[model samples]
Target: MDAATAWLVAAVSLLAAVVGPFAAGHALLTKREPQVATAWIAVCLIFPAGGALLYYLFGINRVYTRARKLVAEERLPPSLAPHPTSSSHGIGPEYAEQIRISDAVTGRPLEPGNRIQVLSNGEEAYPVMLEAIEGARETVMLSTYIFETNTSGRQFIDALSAAHRRGVDVRVLIDGVGEYYTWPRPSTLLRRAGVPVARFLPPRLIPPQLSINLRNHRKILVVDGQRAFTGGMNLGDSHLLQSQRSHRVADVHFLFDGPLAQQMEAVFAEDWAFTTGDERTPPKRATPHDSGALCRTITDGPNEDLDRLVMTLIGALSAAREEIWLVTPYFLPMRPLITSLEAAALRGVEVKILLPERNNLPFVHWATRHILGELLHWGVHLYYQPPPFAHTKLFVVDRRYAQVGSANMDPRSLRLNFELNAEIYNRPIAEQLALDCELIRARSRQLSSAELGERHPAERLRDALCWLASPYL
Candidate 1:
């Protein structure tokens, strides 16, 4: 072919690549959040190849949707969800009512009276979780987005393996991609040891092309249908050691007893039923503890027909009486969230946000700065958690309610990824969470207009370019 003919052929092929999915993406009848739809359109327009790549990477596929339809077609028995006993503590009336609505919507009650404990980092959470697994009697259910079969992951494997051998009804779930070469097949090892493990939304067995975007991003652990844990902590060596690895992630996890733990178990049951089809009639077990805290679990995913994280933040911020505090590894907020944060500060609601000084994704870190400048101007106090990549995501409101989990304040998470979080409304737990925020504050400094202006022109341009591509990040 001549040079002119070759150029025309190349142009035609590129057009087909963009137009095909762009048309299918809109035409498909799958449920999507309004913000996600808007962002998807923006992503397609800005960079065609990049958008196509993202659409393939995290985009929804028809197979899973069809599988869901097939499952819905079957007549399944009622999976028993007996409520757990409550502890001796309940939150104030205002917070309690929100719990009621969440309970109704989620079909899981907040055990009003429960003892809550905060595990500062992996060093604390790891041992506690292992102990919980060690004590499991009826069931030991665990799910994580990233489960490296590395050295650290192996310890968890050993623990779970021991639990399985002890006649504990053990079930483990890991994301197919998150455990990709960096880790080995945890499920395979468990299978060899006669334990049951399933990959949530595993890659399609038939067609390799369909394995692109589907992932189970939830990180949760519930033991014996009683005690439970959830947060950013994944099973890995980096979470334990300051590591020789490229980027060490700092994360937080929670240990729950009382009604909230039951709520977490319910969340696990849903994923378990979806993955294994082992809808065994589980027992009604809720151990009431002495800690006074009101807690509920909230699960979000592409399957959920709403933006749970963004809505929860906006609702909490709008209803704030005195203060609001937040922390996340990624700081890119969509338009509605940005506006909500700005309005909360403008109304004299003490608003503070903590993000990592050095995020694992540097491109995203740079992109988050431009629009974030607008927040600082609106009196939204911004603090950067110093060193070691703070991966914790937290939200506290009015000294009463707080949420902690794996979801970050970024488009990729708020819109695309599946995540799990717990909303707590007990004074002592709230205070403890607030104290954790302050420790991050002690290490982080406030950003000023002066510092933003002092950036080198080259740095500014780099940030600006990345900001334009924020939808994909």
Candidate 2:
């Protein structure tokens, strides 16, 4: 061979030797699923350079390292310190295990004396939130997955700007991907008004971090560090009942008071600190109440605490006795959750799930359809809510316990993105949520086993293809 040809061959061989084993070894060590590891190894062996770059940018979990460092450097105020024991929170002994597991996962104790108000839709939630922002005496913190620049978004912008002008400490955090929903991002408006704002994991090309998959999906709003609002509602005109928009969505949100609100503030503070590198003092504790509802805040993400929401759901489902009523926009749960739901059904516990008939994301809807046969065969009832899509996420167990938050039933909410939910041991709230589920079910069409099995062959093939992409969807 010529010298030039020989030199080229040697370079290619060196590149292969270096990239192939490195990517394979990294995948084997880091990837928990064997299929994922095998896929990475094959890509690395066949297309060495591109595969190595893809693995570096997307496969590796870089957030853990940064999150761990920040967590270690963070100092909690005396008010936010962990309590000695979370056992005596007035939660029944039957729920002792669920409470303990949640505390272990979130590192936040179950707090009592919490007063929760269920806001039926954006009309109810937005007014209360704006009022709280206007009356802020100390600080206002807001975080959301989507902050569209529409009529409702402008209202929030004005309220926040007015609060900032009044010398209230106003800070806002919007997801990097969610800010592109409109021509001018809402963060720009907030910044123009001199409100402190930061985008979580904004898109970048230099470092090549494909952070688009990892989003901050939590919808949280805290005012004066004592009261907070959160759930699935985002800042968009579609959420308004009077919006003339073609597509509108209905959702539920909660306004919280007492110590549970403090926990919500802590989640926002840590996220803000991580994004801006700004140290934050723990929020002051709200005045304790002698008697009220019991609640706990559960935060989960791909950072240090991973798959926490999934684990918590599985645990709750396994322990459910009478019935499970779940409502979500998306419905693509992991294998373990599916198994737990099946088990619950086998034991004669009613398992009913409510999902939007026409989801905003067509691919996700198709994927969810592919799994319905299995669940239906196992005696789990599936109901589809007819149109003007519903974005609410809620779960009620035995009409006595309930969980509501921004997390959906899909893998994105379970294992990929950052999510927060409130677990309530209050019978009144659970009953109200159950009634809401009943209302949704009243408008929903339940699919029978035979109906699910009657899907056309071509449609089934399409659904199967979409189901294959569920892990990343």
Candidate 3:
């Protein structure tokens, strides 16, 4: 009622009104996703100060600025540049448009003469990785999202330490958040053993440079620049066999030999440079193998290359004429990806998606089930694989193109976390992957429209609530 109190209230109201629209305008300008932008704008308008602070802390595009600086300052060899005539590679005229799109997005060419060998789980991949590390003549580069100090992790640590002791240039990078599995992280163990190790974006609260959300989820290993391994397997006991454990995790990993390996190495080198601030000379290009496998490496994250992987997937789906088979542990596809799949299905393309029966992350499982009804309604067959929780990330299109790597279908892998995948244009590899998919499908239970319709009301409500959080899941 007093004039002074009225003046104070009026000033505060005026300030909030001015600040709210400014923040909302900033969100509208920066956010690419219409839904995200609208949500942020509404929040900024309704909550003002609190919304502005939250946006300042979490909504800004910090990664893109840092990534641009890193890329600009990092000196890379000319050999890492895209090949000029790679467009003419034997991807067929039908896939030419997709290839061009991929090339423009990734700045990498379709490399030919690469040989790929699929490795199933840690049982198959670990021995080969250890052997390659032991035989390393010059350098060994290893990076993974999770590097737990468990049985398999210890073995890897030993191999890497031994390699370092033998004077091989060994560098290891592990995700900071993932390294907290044990008291002394695997990176610490490697560092104690004199192996050079760096943690990607360790937790920091003061300067606030690191992020727990934007993780490095890529799993890559290159030995001597000649052989490389990558896929869904991380360094942990969970991935390896333990007789006492009844349920285990299954995944698909791959070994690459030839020119494609160099591209993989280039990715590792770039990450290493970004983390350690060390200038790296490009690794020698591996000789092309006799095999005619044409492959290209695709890396995506929330940085400058945001949505590249999802765009690549959409392009591949649009190009598919016969079939699309995808296997992932988690499934929370973006709107564009879902639309692409629906369009492909409408065009008579067989769209089959296989997911784990039970996921380690319960929230992700619930969120994934939320989208099944729409997919099933659109003629996109959904299959739930039986347990031992398959964590394989794979995609095969038209029995002529295949992709395998560390990315899941969720927002975390596709948009938030750093991820890598290899696209193969070889039919033999694609056929083998297709056969593997079939074997998995034989054990999976397909979800029909009736099955989804029969879900309990409470379960449906839970799924809807979980789906609401899919952007963060």
| Ten contiguous residues minimizing lDDT sum, candidate 3 | 72-81
C-alpha local distance difference test of each model: 0.73, 0.85, 0.84
Clashes of 3: 0
TM-score per candidate, chains pooled: 0.84, 0.93, 0.91
lDDT of 2: 0.85
lDDT of 3 by residue, 1-473 (tens): 99999999999888888877888999898787888899889988899877876776567556666676446243322243335756666456866766767776777777888888899888899999999999998999999988878788899999999999999999998988888866567877888999999988888788776466778899999988878899999877787654456657899899988888888888888788888988678889788877669888998886644477987899899999999999999999888999999999999999999999888898888877788889888899999998888899999999888889999998878877888999888889999999999999998998788877888999888989998878777
Residues 1-473, candidate 1: write the lDDT tens digits. 99999999999778867765673466244424555565666665665667765655565444345345323223222223323322223334666445534543444456665666677666788889988988888788898887777877788889999999989988888777676746357778778888888877667656654444546677888887667788888887778645677667777888877766666666676677777786645446677766557676666666554466676667777777788898888888888999999999999999999888887789999998877779988999988777788888888887678888878888777765777888887777787888888888988898887788889999999999899778667
Off by over 4 Å in 1: 1-91, 96-107, 209-211, 241-246
Full candidate order by TM-score, most accurate first: 2, 3, 1
Query: How much RMSD separates candidate 1 from the native structure?
Result: 5.1
Candidate 1: 10-residue stretch with minimal lDDT: 70-79
Q: Estimate the lDDT of model 1.
A: 0.73
Cα displacement (angstroms), candidate 3, residue 263, comes to 0.9
